[model samples]
Target: MDDPAAPRWPARATAGLCVVLLAWNTLVVPALPGRPASAVAANVAATGVLLAGARWSGLTWAELGLARRRLPAGARWGGACAALVLAAYGVALAVPALRPLLADARAGGLDGPAVAVRALVRVPLGTVLWEEVAFRGVLLAAACRLLPLRAAVALSCAVFGLWHVRPALGGLAANDLAGGPVATGAAVLLTVLWTAVAGLLFAWLRLRSGSLLAPVLLHLATNSLGVLAAAAATRGG
Candidate 1:
């Protein structure tokens, strides 16, 4: 529970800023002409903003899961997350029905150069670093200060789901209801649901490990798998 004497406005302001930044990152950035690059830049900027906001809000590194000593543990959890995702991919390959979600039409043939860029720049700097900082670090930490622990987790998870709205919209556009509108809707819902669940898992890891490194690694692994899956599908793997 929040301290009885702590002023509430700063926390509320921090949370509001996070939601706005997420929407801008997901929705606005993608539409910009510079895109990908601009998006990455924006993410980098967001990280700085979150760190500054945390300080302004008087939040500690420990509260945001940034304790240096716990980084190794976070890395281990990240490895576990990667393994789980990879195992899921293995299962998807064996089950045709699961292929649609993993190997969607959007998985278009991999462009080696683009993949390299994403692996090096986009995934690391933008998706993994920026998001984990914003969601798991900043947002969750602020929420925790304002609400009960469980409620805070849920709120952060829900925000995480909304943050993926653009991607889900892209997925819908790519499929064009080839799977039927109902199926498409169901798939989108499932995707968002999964994102929220992952957010919850990441938040738990951050809370337990006391370091954002764990969620960052897990998040990186998760995104990396998408890149790998695209490459494999393109190559007939």
Candidate 2:
């Protein structure tokens, strides 16, 4: 017989919260009053809300892949991944044909000090941290409560891909690289697909190392180091 006193998983609440958060991240935050600062603030606020909701939904830190005891293992795994990303970026920059891939218009105008601040400070805090916390930590953990781990990862990663859709749409409009409606649509689809694949890898890292730190470090390296690499590549041209 089933235990009559056991707490239920609250599937409805989890689904509702995920929906709200998904909209907040993809829609509301983008239209916030101030850019960069407002966006960062909104995301931080969202992270707190996610944690609080997770707690309300009876999720433990361990369930969220953030157990204190797993810190060392997570760090080791994360650090290794980060180092590999740096090395790959270095190689990309070193190779003439691969160098163009790193040459981005985004970092082309950045001065040394600005690049330093953007890469070391802003990207780490504003982008990587919030994203990993939101996707792999809260969302994946919440999904696991109702579905199997594989299904949970799939759902969370799908949301992560959709999370990028707004940004991708805005970005394509701002840049001439993907001109025309069909081209823009294609670019957005590719962006979603690529980000979804990246999200799957991040979820794997989080689960494999038993800590959110693993994905955080890798994400930090990919975004922050990629910025530096882009600056260098742009300067090289």
lDDT of each: 0.76, 0.83
Report how far residue 42 has shifted in candidate 1, in Å.
1.3
All candidates: TM-score = 0.84, 0.92
Poorest 10 consecutive residues by lDDT, candidate 1 = 1-10
The sequence of per-residue lDDT tens digits that candidate 1 reaches over residues 126-171 is 7888888888887877777777789888988988887877788776
Give the TM-score (vs. native) of candidate 1.
0.84
CA displacement after TM-score superposition, residue 235 of candidate 2 (Å): 2.3
Which prediction has the highest TM-score against the true structure? 2
Model 2: weakest 10-residue lDDT segment is 1-10
Best by lDDT: 2
List, residue by residue over 135-224, the lDDT tens digit for candidate 2: 898777777766777888998888889888887876665444768888888999999999999999999999889999999999999999
Model 2: residue 197 alpha-carbon error in angstroms: 0.8
lDDT score, residue 22, model 1?
70
Model 1: lDDT of residue 66 = 83
